[model samples]
Target: MPTHTDQVPETPRRRPPLGPEHRWVILGVGVAAQASFSAMFSGIPVTAITMRADYGLSTGELGLVLGCTALGVAASDIVWGLLTDRFGDRRILLTGLISTGALLVLMSLAVVPTGDGRPPMPLLAAGLLLAGVLGGSVNGSSGRAVMTWFREGQRGLAMSIRQTAIPVGGAVGVALLPWLAASHGFRPVYAVLAAFCLVTAVATWKWLHEPDDAPQGGGGTAGEPVRERSPLRSREVWRLALASALLSVPQMAVLTFAAIFLHDAEHAGAVAGPLVVLVGQLGGGAARVWSGRYTDRHGNRRGYFRTVGALSGVVIACAAGLTLAGAPVLLTASALAAGGVLANAWHGVAYTEIATMAGARRAGAALGLEGTTLFTVGFVVPLAIPVLLEQSSWSVVWAVAALAPLLGVPLAPGRRP
Candidate 1:
């Protein structure tokens, strides 16, 4: 008879723990993936002038076209989130990036203007809508992947770093796309954006991955009952999602229209408009990073989120007042910067809270739901802004936006929830 050791099957060797370098690697890949999609979506506003000139579109028409992308995103965000939950982040992200890039290329080919200089608005809108559908994959997949890699204590910082990609990508798009559209035309801008998506797709395929030991459905501790298996059923999740969606109103308002406001209302120069947007984005990115760090150390995610929202309300209220009073350009710009920074700073923390509430297994779905709500807001807000501007002044618009964040304060999750 064989001894116990000789008769027993050999245990499979465990994979080595991720090294220090791996953390940064994951963070870099996540940031890159998020940034590519962010640039594509946020870049739309930068091309408004070019599109208006080439396609003979009015401000309302252009706003409608831009809003189409958000509608697409809202429609698909939850589906992509569910996909990430089922198929894993790597596959979903790669599929999204590659397919979205291909669609962008198709849009460049199929949606151009004719001899009459009138583009088929419906077709262009459809293309952007389709692109938004594909582009929705980035946020959930990238966020889930980062969550798997980072420990709970470090998640706020990691997610914040990932979130910073939005403003960073937007800043780049705002800085580069306008000039490209002015000099080279819309087709080149589309092609360049497609190239970025493709390149990032390749990079993500190479570098992005979930932890080997990650759990499915609910990231549970050993022997712990799965707490967030049905994230949609949880009332807390709904509350948080609602608050996030409401808070996004002001942020999107500034992002989509700040440059136009600066140029048209404030009479700031062309260069000054984009420059201010770029600076605001930089400030927003920094605030996100700082907020993430603060939340991680303080361990009060909800409080931090509420505090940021309240502060955003104050800043935007002040900005509305300044704009209405015809304050100096410097004062108006400062208010915009402060509002943008505070409004945007809460995103990472809010996402972290969602992920925490849902657990790892269900985080994709939770994030997807939140994204869906926020993108729905994004879709509606742009369309509404034009109508608001038509009916009222920029001051009226800003004043209304200021109220959005304040509305979110009461909805912010509590420590237990």
Candidate 2:
């Protein structure tokens, strides 16, 4: 055997003791970073109407541009995760945000439509794709920062709050981007998003950091933690990632097409359908925060994750049934939106468990895996909905969506997790 002194221990160097307020500040930076990215990620689609008009894009071209961002994100997630694992959260996040911002600024100058001319479609696609590849860094790296800063018991709450960035940034983006594109131009729209990214990058550089008190290998564990392996090799990580993807199908359906289904198919009042979609966004955000806190207090992350999926399956099935049976528009809209709240709520809990089980050391890769699958689902659901609509009815699409969460329930991790 090698001498004891020859066997150097590998661990994260101990951090200095941080003031409690600092952790919250770090969390805020994470939220801001994620929100800015989310604004660019999910918000791009909201400007679809103006984008199609400005770029003079056909239907197929519209879909291509819309999907490019997600495709780039999905393609780059694992690479960013690996880099986060190697370099740590601060470097990766700072680098990602700054580069992504610079890219968007460039796109605003070159790729967006001018008064008389639009850039080639492929050039626009490539720029958006690169923006996504860079922004993908935010998901895992910021998540890893939270994993390092927050204690195990508080991770659920922290991550849920971080997850809120999606709707928060999305709300801001959808509210502004369409109007900006319509009134000023696509250049202003892209420039504004770039401004958000650059602002968040400045804040992140200033305040975000590893706790001085944090142990290097990972945070949130005490005294001689269990040996960890690559997240790719862990069955538990795989299951959670897969389950996250499956559960996302229904949520994506509601998010992607709730308005169309309610307005076009059900013939609801114009405002009523979009109104329900807004309610779903608000309710889902509230539910995510509440569920995170509940699980953190009760120590029931796995149970909550699985139970929510099952309940969502039932709720979505009810909505599908109602749609098929020709239920009144009011009733169907209410059911679908309710189902959305539950479907969206599990994200924080599932992400918490995935990071916890994989150990904070490998949290980046595990969370990266989750991000990959979820974005892939987000990408695929929109494409699939059109085909499903062609094959059958809106009711049939709802039926397919209802099945997603139920299938996810069975893949919930082992009991101890």
Instruction: For each candidate in the order shown, give its overall lDDT on alpha carbons.
Output: 0.83, 0.81
Best by lDDT: 1
Residue lDDT tens for model 1, 265-348:
888866666666677677889999998899899899999888889889889899899999999977887787778778778899
Stretches of model 2 off by over 4 angstroms after superposition:
1-17, 56-61, 114-120, 216-226, 260-274, 325-328
What tens-digit string does per-residue lDDT give for candidate 2 at 40-62?
87667656656777888864576
Candidate 1, overall lDDT? 0.83
Structural similarity to truth (TM-score) of each candidate: 0.92, 0.88
Which residues of candidate 1, in runs, are more than 4 Å off? 1-21, 114-116, 216-225
Instruction: Give RMSD (Å) of candidate 2 vs. truth.
Output: 6.8
Candidate 1: residue 311 lDDT (0-100): 88
Worst 10 residues of 2 by lDDT: 218-227
